[model samples]
Target: MQGPHSPAPPVDVQPASWRDLSSIRELEKLCFGRDAWPWIDTLAALTFPQTVRLKAVSDEFVVGFIFGDQRRLKRTGWIASIGVHPDYRRRGIGRTLLVACEDLLGMPRVRLSLRGSNDAALRLYQQAGYVRIDTWKRYYRDGEDAIIMEKVR
Candidate 1:
């Protein structure tokens, strides 16, 4: 028997593999909608040896995912993508996934781009210590501007 005030168990974070592509693709569609990457790019992120791919799994399904690209020459890492299933939002899953990718990237600075209109994402990134650095006008296919944010370690 458990007490009414008992805290829930913690979720697990792990490196994702190509086998997780299907689950990740589903989550991508749910979170990014029209901005989701194509299947080929998703596959590459999961299977590429040097790429950092992390997934937040609960109940044996992927709830969130993040991909990081390490640019050694540039001395920075870029967050290629991040997504949390709609059912899993606001539970710190996205933040956990981002932190895991940052750790794996092991770079001095990490950067990500988001639609300028995505207030929720902007707030999350801001709370996690990322600051807006630049903006790309009409960067998305739908002609939405993208705000670039960076966290220096």
Candidate 2:
């Protein structure tokens, strides 16, 4: 058993497959709660073509996940979702997943939306070179505005 001060286990970021459905579903619930995607959506995201699905595995368990939707015509990759298990926060896992998704997406521009009240997420995105470009009023189920952030290479 690891003590509170013990360093976290090594985490590996890799492509996620349909077999990760259950893990991803649980992660969605843990991360998004009411905003979590339906099972069908999660499955589709895992199986759909032209989408990037990645998972961060630590000690053989999924600790984080990211989904990137590539829109060729729009010339932008949308970060459909990203979440790290609560216990894994502040360990650079989210940022690692974000960067991995961006690199694999190979798009000139990448975008994502988040609840405006998520200060930690905002800081992470900002530190990763994302800038707020727009706001969708009442975008979330609870009427929280969604802040749209974009990073351009």
Candidate number achieving the greatest lDDT relative to the actual structure: 2
Q: Write one digit per residue (lDDT tens) for candidate 1, span 36-66.
A: 8999999999988669999888867788899
TM-score of each: 0.92, 0.96
Q: Per-residue lDDT for 114 in model 1?
A: 92
Q: lDDT tens string, model 2, 82-126? A: 999999999999999999999999999999999999999999999
Where does candidate 1 stray beyond 4 Å?
Answer: 1-9
When summed lDDT is taken over every stretch of 10 residues in candidate 1, the lowest stretch is 1-10
lDDT of 1 at 60: 79
Worst 10 residues of 2 by lDDT: 137-146
Error of 2 at 96 (Å): 0.4
